[model samples]
Target: MTEGDSPMSSIFAAMAPVPERTIADATTLDAAIRAADTPFVVRGLVLDWPLVQAGLKSAQAARDYLAAKRKDVAFTVSVGEAGSNGRLFYDDAMAMNFRVGRGKLPDIFGHIASIENQPDAPPVYLASIDMDGFFTGLADENHVDLGDRDLLKSIWIGTRTRIAAHNDFPQNLACCAVGRRRFTVFPREQFRNLYLGPIDNTPAGRAVSMVDFHDPDFQQHPRFGEALAHAQMVELEPGDAIYLPSLWWHHVEGLAPFNVLVNYWWRDTPRWLGQPQDALNHAIMSIRELPADERAYWRDMFDYYVFGDPELPRAHIPEGAQSVLGPLTADSAGRLRGFLLRQLSK
Candidate 1:
């Protein structure tokens, strides 16, 4: 059988080993993708058309076209490890979803879609694209040639290829053409449960999929509850996609031997009232400019908001007061923290 036709040889194949699931019902796929926590919710989501017909019905034809147009493909700028940096993949790492300006994209993998023959390489990240420039055109309807946007950023995600837990910058709609996929989602609050890989927003691909809900070792990750309570997941078939919110952690797997998918990356509204704090730059500044003790203090201070517990981590100013904390309250800590935030923003 040709690579595309042998849909069961993938690691996530029906024959492959997996944890027993308690998932019930076999109705709407979107519900499973959004609410499934245990194997308890195993079903199908039959959406995304051009993909299913083109991939499953005419596998050979699609593969032939994909192979011939390899050079025309211009994505695969490794954001992180499909293994090592799986966490980064969680947040709109899929090239297509990002409403990126031409200035931001690096075109790292180049547009040539190479039919990967290397055993070391995976096939699940096989075929995908963004077409951001294409959509932007619909709004303005200007003379958008999509010339430089010619780079086809598709992932030939090999089957059994697993991506770690993480969320995208926004909601993503993915369409599978030839194969099927599985996704597990953790809401934004579950960031701690996921043993995140890197601070660099982009992923170079990673080995570990985010949280292992199948048989979680709660003892090892005590704080994992923050993730467990908000879990959602699903298995995607040809022509199906999942909509994931920003900061939500998710693990993904290519279920079929020959998997082909197309996803759109879109952003959610900004989280902060003002521009996002340049925490990275601050981290660098602390490490470089401060003495060792000062740096450590700042590090802890940073943790108070980013990693510290939710109840009383750091402080923030109230909405409409003259006090540094915005509004004055009986709590002095909040004011002090607001002062610090102001200092940081400056």
Candidate 2:
């Protein structure tokens, strides 16, 4: 049989494994999040939630449930022509392939209600609306009690749609609240094989893979075959959830005519550590085009000074004299930031 026709167990057997763990309730979910270093599926984690109950009744019931909680707040929604077949991607010339506009929460819900059952309808997505900001009580009604007050809770509502493969900076808990959803995930090390798009100007907020998952042109993106070999697929039913570690690439597909997904994102890093993307951008600007030998030398330097044991580098130096290379407190981080600003000014 062809690879496409092979059983899922056979396909997954060929690739690296993604584990599945069952957590009985929300309390256990918090522990799982803290302990899990890899991506995992949590079966029926939110099955008892009221939102899931409403969704199980009917799509209309779910819509009404959301509408009742929405406080007339406006959020951005993405619209694409029906011709695109729900894939949000780029055209031949590499322009944004869809239109994004602002609309109210209730209005978007009405739009979903009007077209949900139609056999042919344009893709409409209320992508990544902050749930706590727009629907104030929604988090309280249905939520993951991770106990992190700063955790970001967001809502995704859309018609049948496919989001291109992309990575996020924070740890993600994507809960399928209303409809079935599919996720194809790849480990962070597969970055090169994914045929990623431009870093600076992205179709979505994050840089997405240029290689379309539905109909990848193997001739143009041959490495994508390698990526596919390593992919792990999961189908999440209503109330199922998946934990995606930071930097894991994922492609998402909404299987139903209308879908509502609730996601929580947070970082364990200290606030002073800042974003690693900034350092990556600086490295690209300063080091990417350097000679091979110089690049190798810098790589070794980074391995030793940055990724190596923090104590190893500063063990011999006096605490007061260690400067930027020593333990980083808020004051030291501020000084380092000032130093970087001065360097950039030149």
Q: What's the TM-score of each model vs. the native?
A: 0.48, 0.89
Deviation from truth (RMSD, Å), model 1:
11.2
Deviation from native of the Cα of residue 107 in model 1, angstroms: 19
lDDT by candidate, in order shown = 0.44, 0.84
| Candidate 1 ranges with C-alpha deviation above 4 Å | 1-48, 68-156, 205-219, 222-226, 268-346
Indicate the worst ten consecutive residues by lDDT in candidate 1: 137-146
Point out where model 2 deviates above 4 Å.
Answer: 1-18, 291-297
Candidate 2 lDDT, 267-302, residue by residue in tens: 888778788888988999999999999999999889
RMSD of each: 11.2, 3.4
Write the residue-wise lDDT of candidate 1 on 114-160 in tens digits.
Answer: 32333323222432443343223211211111222222333343433
Task: lDDT for model 2, please.
Answer: 0.84
